[model samples]
Target: MTTLEPAAVADLVRNTLAAHKSLFLATAGSTGPWVGGVYFAESGEFTLNLVLEDRGRTLAAIRENPVVSVVVSTGSPMQPFLQAQALAEILGRDEDARARELLVTKVPEAAPFLAAPVTAVRLSIRKWRATDIANGVLPGAELPSPRLP
Candidate 1:
């Protein structure tokens, strides 16, 4: 697999984030495992922010375990797809305010949930992979590693 430089990876990740509203999150719940789709936002460093129901299964699982995997993809034929293994945790009071602001900008659809009792998760991405990131390549065939520093 080819590897991308930090700047290029950040650019591609940002583009992927901007291009998709939904992301598939995989988590290990106390009962078992789960995968759910959630709307997301990205921090300047590209950390993923998710607003979820406090009592939802995904959140419950997150409380049990912070580790998670997420996939953010672009449907445009010309765009690349990005995925990451991340560690998720509820936001602190200090972080919540800013994260909420950022989240609202990307998904105004989340405004209602922000005011309610909800779980705000920040996924600190550990590893990232991309497809169709190469100049002349087919989508999904190449696993390009984004060695994020």
Candidate 2:
């Protein structure tokens, strides 16, 4: 098993995050596991910003359990996609301004959606695993060692 260089893997992850419009967020709830699609913007190399309905189940679940999994993909076999393990947090009012800017900058169509009652979320990505068959990278080939520093 050959491990790709960290720089190469980082670039793949960054490009995938930039090209994708949304991500599938999976959280554990009292009922069970729940998954939902939500628009996101990369706030940093290891963090994502999201605007979710304040009363939504996803947020409710996050409040109960901060650990979550997120996937950034278009569901195309020919393209690259990434899976990440992250810790979720509901941003406070003071942090919302910056998160909102990042979201609007990435997805202009999301501006109106911000008007509704919603809150900003931050996903602190811990590890990234990616697959790019087009690049001859098989599944799990790009998994980071242990976790991101």
RMSD of each: 3.8, 2.1
Q: At residue 38, give the lDDT of candidate 2.
A: 90
Over 21-129, each residue of candidate 2 has an lDDT whose tens digit, in order, gives: 7999999989689999999999766889998898989888998999999988888877888888899888988888889999999999889989999999999988788
Pairs that collide, model 2: none
- True-structure lDDT of candidate 2: 0.85
Summarize candidate 1's per-residue lDDT along 1-149 as a digit string, tens digits.
45556666667666667788788899997789999988888875448887888778989998999889887764454567777778887998878787788889989998988888887788888766666645543333323334344
TM-score of each: 0.79, 0.91
Look at candidate 1 and give me any clashing residue pairs.
none
Give the winner by TM-score.
2
Measured by lDDT, the strongest candidate is 2
**Reference-based lDDT, each prediction:** 0.75, 0.85
